[model samples]
Target: MLYQNFSKTPVLAAAATSLLLLLLLSSTAHAEAPMAANEATEVVISASRIEMARESSGSAITVLDSDYLEQNQVQVVSDVLRDVPGVAVSRTGGAGAPTQVRIRGAEANQTLVLIDGIEVNDVASGSEFNFAHLMNLEVERIEVLRGAQSALWGSDAMGGVINIVTKRGKGSLNGKITVEGGSYDTHQETLAINAGTDDYHYALSGTLLNTNGISAASEERGNREKDGYKNATINLKSGIDLLDNLSMDLVVRHVKSDVDTDSFLGGVGAVDSDDNTETEQTSGKVSAKLDLLDEQWHHRLSFSANDTDNTFFTAGTESYNSQGYKQKYEYQTDLFLYSSLTNSDDLEHRFTFAAEHEEEEFYNKGFSTIDRDMDVSGYVVEYGANIDDRYYATVAGRRDINSLFQNANTYRLTFAGWVTDSVRLHTSKGKGIKNPTLFELFGSTPDYTGNADLRPEENSTWDVGTEYHFNALDGYVDLTYFHTDVTNLITGSGQTSVNMPSDAKIKGVELSLVLRPSDNTRLNSSYTYTDSNDGNGNELVRRPEHVASINGSYLFSNDQTRLTTGVQYNGKQDDIEYDANWNTSTVTLSDYTLVNVALTHQLNKHIELFGRVDNLLNEEYEEVLTYGTKGINGMVGITITGSL
Candidate 1:
């Protein structure tokens, strides 16, 4: 039933036209050549909890820099993740609606998210982070590492890791202010300031957003009510040098939001109602670092805490509330075991050791009062070696002791080597474990129950990939194949949760290309094919079988103006449908494509004008079964930059 009418002719034609125009305009332009394999030295931090050369790491990682984020001009963080190779994003409705991100067909909670080194997952809501309230106002960089990573991170790392690093102050005092307004009576304002010197640095940023959104239910179904949302966020980052060899850093963030929601009926799905949700999130982290022995030995100690409160209202009265609190303490050390440099060869060996303790508490108040808490202690060790800058290997192991579940031990191995001057091969194998969330073990509601006997899910994954660098084309191509097998799959049986009797399997292929055809033009494209099956040989819900995207940018007019365009395609997928009696059955969602364009012009050194059109094609689509999506819409704004 799926893919019967799927067509790619329209999207391919559009992409071809755009590329032709780019080539025609850049025929005579001259620019510096792209960096070669040996000359490139980008560092990735999330793969090993420390900075390592991207070319030497075996893990698949996608790094989005500040420039890329600025060019996209997206307000929500999840919008940017859609361009990553293995990520899938689903939003129930418009902006501020509940959103979920899955990597490689894994469950939403299986992915680990980190912001400024702090874990912000909600312990009371199945240990998953909601992307509805996560804005991209102060992000400097994002690192997406895909694969099983429990050997490095304790839990919730079966799918992958998304690490976001915020901007830090540097140089003289500088700041920026922005204001924008768009369709659906939407408006946003942002302010940021930063100042730093050799010994001290700090940055502060804030954003406010308000939108009169569309209906959460499908408009075709005759829903006419307009839901609204409002959000405010503030962030601060600072660091100070206590001594020549010691330093300390601090990070704090606060977010408050309120969003109107709709009710869900058994047969009718989403229906208009005077329902809403209010959420407050606060998180902070402090860390100290010390270096000795000619800066070869490093040690760090850190403490982090996160608190979240959510209140759900029915009609005009508050019906339920939940709170989640988490605290973590950790210490880690890195040592250089050996190092040697020669004209012909360079070699190095390193070791890392870490210990962590974490505590979580969940509380819910409604018809039934529930309170639960859990603690975990973990230790990890890793060794890495690089031979002649062409061969790399890493081995790691971890031991975790849980207060409510069985103890777990995990391990990982990776290797990367250059097979030729223009080709490189990389592979990794790892094991991961995710403990049952507090809510799944003790939570109780009118429609659902919890089972304390549920077991933790376990996964084993492996991936092999190769990279080819084209010197003549000034581009690179990457292809990878990945597979994962998961045992002890957790699912809901009637009203309570239970472990599946069979195992789940997932396999996928990813291909990506990047080309700097000209100094003034850049192009990027990616395609993914996924085949996922549940224990009972049924396709997983919301996991599309095929996805593709193409994005390009062109700069002209004395390098003062830029034009960018992008297109994304999502193939047909399955979703669960409920009848009047709450019986569930599978339904297929039609495939759709979306087009977007953005432009920016620099008026001067201090003032800039920017605008973007989303859903330019105005194609009707649905990411979720009954969720409504916005049509063609556009927004325009101005930015002012100056020194404080």
Candidate 2:
């Protein structure tokens, strides 16, 4: 079955295979010159809760920097994620619609999302973070760490972690203003400012967006009413040096959104309707860091909170509302036991200890009034060693004490080493857990019931990969194989949710390549082959067996003009469909290909102009059954940057 589905996109598959073979053969070729000196050492913070060189971490991670976001003209964060290997994105409708991201075929709720080190999953919605309102206006970079990670992040890390880091103030006072307009009566305006000094620094940004989107229901299915969306967001980050060894930082963000939606008819799936939803979210964090023992020991104390409120209206009448709140207090210390530079041996050792207490509350008002709260405490310990910067190893463990359900313990082990100056090998093995959400345990509605007997889902995963750097092209190629076993899968059956008795299996291979054929041109590409099945021998829904993407950028006209292009392919996948009688049947959604292009020109030192076209090929596709997707759309914008 997987082979048949993969064969559907023979062209894409063959191209990806050819590229993989080419890179593999090139790895054995001798380079004419050494690696570039300016090749910056990429550092990852989410992999271990501290900064570590990317090559030193065994986890499969991908980092998308701000420059990439700007070059791609990305507005929604999910748009960029689709290009990542082993990650899948599904949107129910158009922009601002409900969106879900799955990693390694794991459930969406099992993927942990972090914003500047603060968890932001929606408790009222089953511990899932909606990417609908996650714009890239103020984002500095995004780190997608794959595989099981419960040992470091605790619950909801069964799939992986996506950490979003926002920009911080630095250098002189500077800012930028951007305005854009496009098809579907869409327009957006954004402003950002940053300033920093030796003692204090601050960064602030705001964005407003409005769009008369397409119908949430498929237009081809006789739905013509247009659904619209509106959003407003604000973010602020500041830091102050309290003392020579002590410093404090604060971050706050707020978002408000309104989206029009369609109704689901019993036998007809989705239809035009007078329905809408409004959501408001606020999140904040404060932390103080102290250094002791001549900077060998570091301590951090922090508090963070996230709140979300959502209301739905049908035919302009109140229907239902929900609210979710979460707060956490945490303390962590890192002790440097030994360093190669300080000791005579060529080995270094470090230890980290952390403790956290978190509380979550969920409330709903509709057919049934549901209010629930849960708390958990967690402790984590980790040991890491580096031998002459050629070999690295880490062992981490965590114990969680929960107010409800069974207590859980998880651990992870990782190893990475340099095989040659241009080749590296990395691998990791880990266990993860996801506790049942309050909505799944207590909430009840006319169409569904909660199952308090639900147990937490458990997952075990492992991955091994190799990276080869081509000194001639100033690029690299990476290949990895990963597998996961999931037990006690929580799923909906009839009117209530239940944990399946069978274990699910997911395994995949990922291939990625980067090449700078010339100083003026660069290319990036990735391919993933996944095989996912439930214990009952059924393929998971919405998880394509084969996915591939290619993106390229070119600079010309005296380095003042840039052109970027991207193409993505998604293989056929299974989905569930319901009729008027609520009878469900499995269906295969057809494969699709999307093309996008962008052109930007630096008008001057302080002014820039850009234009972008999405769905350039106007391909008709459905990411979710009965959901409408936009056709070819275009937008033009201008940006102005200056110092205050």
Clashes of 1: 0
lDDT of 1 at 36: 23
Off by over 4 Å in 1: 1-40, 339-343, 472-474, 493-495
- Compared with the true structure, model 1 gives a TM-score of 0.92
Per-residue lDDT over 58-147 for candidate 2, one digit per residue giving the tens place of the 0 to 100 score: 999988888788889999999999888899999988889899999989889999999988899998788899999999977888999999
Q: What value of lDDT does candidate 1 attain over all alpha carbons?
A: 0.84
- Taking all chains together, each candidate's TM-score versus the true structure is 0.92, 0.92
Q: What range of 10 consecutive residues in model 1 has the weakest lDDT sum?
A: 1-10
In model 2, the Cα lDDT at residue 218 comes to: 88
Best by lDDT: 2
